[model samples]
Target: MHRSKGIVIGFWVVTALLCLQMGFTAYAQLSMPEVAEAIAQLGFPHYFRKELAWAKLLGVVLLLAPVPARLKEWAYAGFAYTLVSALIAHLAMGHGPESWIYAVVTGVLWGLSYFFWRRLQAPSVGLRPATA
Candidate 1:
């Protein structure tokens, strides 16, 4: 089935935004001492900051590359899990909205990206909200 132009555009835009946010955060975590201190303050080990940053970079690559559908799905799921976990960590640490708001905004971007992705996949036998 041919994909709809609108859906294709929507997928790219939202996915780009999501990837950008993740990628920027990963960069910050890797390069900024402040980020490391913040992560430590949140009760996460120092190593976790590196691990999470690398994982985010990997997930961003997977989402942007023309990988298998299963891999793409896994990347999306990983991002969703990361966002939720971040929110929980912030809340558990009693951080104010400024600290946790990143997760909330990223989650919205993630949702839009996933939604458009699903619509792009709606071309199979049972899918309906897909392309033209």
Candidate 2:
């Protein structure tokens, strides 16, 4: 398979994984009072969880859409931001090994999304003149 195709495939795989993770996180937030209690136990701001959940849902939509490159770029940016914040929150709270594992997974997913976003932004063969 072509390298671009491979990148796209990787993008989708990462996207799916993120969607699963974030979707479940959102579900837990929405349905599981225990999750809220847990978040409260961490002593972090509440907005982080709510906003992260929404951002994840929106990011998934952008990845799935056939929109312009700029929007896709923004989508990846959102993913990166969310994941990084999650990593930070986990670290600051002194969670055990699972925290590091989650950070690594989020980093890998962000890297994959970043790779594809950059690829999409590259100038196409038959496209318009390059911007200066």
Candidate 3:
């Protein structure tokens, strides 16, 4: 069966939202004092903030752009890894479960976006015409 236009639009919408979220996160990490303080409290080096911000920004671009399929796959994987690691880090630091809610939500969004992306990539299967 042919893929529905609605599905494609939905995929794009989710991907766009994910991009916006990541962009905002990267910006906050790079410039927000509170975020820097939290990072320090977590025992991460000051320079890690900048590195993570840049990496997240790059991931957002890779997800949104019409890049190679492999690159897009890597972007999805990267976001998944980032979110999971964030949750783990929060838990490791003895932060309350509530502290990891953002990571959980983002992880769900990433999974949905990746599912739709893979669905869109799949070729439609239909019966072929019979030959004489």
Candidate 4:
């Protein structure tokens, strides 16, 4: 079955958004004192800035790659998990609402993308196609 145009657009949008978020998070690690303070407060001193940068970059690549459908689904699942984790981190660390904005958007975008993907899947042979 062909992918829906909406899903394709959503996939690109999510990829770009993830990249933008990665850039902002990476930059915050250097430019914002709050990032370091938050990290410290979270008690993960060894989890340096580079780790998050690399993870986000890798996640973006995985989501954008021309992998098998199953692999793509797995990538989306991973990305969703990461978004939720980031949201929790921000809330637990007392970061502003802005810090969790990406997480919220990512979650919504992923949900929409996944919904379209599922809707586009071919129906089983045992079932009759829906009549218009």
Q: Which should have the higher lDDT, number 1 or number 4? A: 1
TM-score of each: 0.91, 0.74, 0.90, 0.64
Model 2, residue pairs in steric clash: none
Which tens-of-lDDT digit does each residue in 75-120 have in candidate 2? Answer: 8777777667667766788877665586577678668767775775
Query: How far is 130's C-alpha from truth in model 2 (Å)?
Result: 15
- What TM-score number comes out for model 1? 0.91
**C-alpha RMSD for every candidate:** 4.2, 4.3, 1.9, 4.6
Error of 1 at 30 (Å): 0.6
* Candidate with better lDDT, 2 vs 4: 2
- List model 4 lDDT by residue over 67-102, tens digit each: 677876776676677778878888888888887887
lDDT of 4: 0.68
Candidate 1 regions exceeding 4 Å error are 124-132
Clashing residue pairs in candidate 1, if any? Answer: none
Instruction: List model 1 lDDT by residue over 25-101, tens digit each.
Output: 99999999999999999899889999999999999999999999899999999999999999999999898999999
Tell me the lDDT of model 4 at 105: 81
Model 4 deviation from native, Cα RMSD in Å: 4.6
**10 residues in a row with least lDDT, candidate 4:** 119-128
Candidate 4 C-alpha error for residue 50, in Å: 2.9
Candidate lDDT values, in order: 0.93, 0.71, 0.88, 0.68
Residue pairs with clashing backbones, model 3: none
Task: Give the range of the ten consecutive residues with the poorest summed lDDT in model 2.
Answer: 120-129
Off by over 4 Å in 3: 127-132
lDDT of 4 at 123: 51
Candidate 1, overall lDDT? 0.93
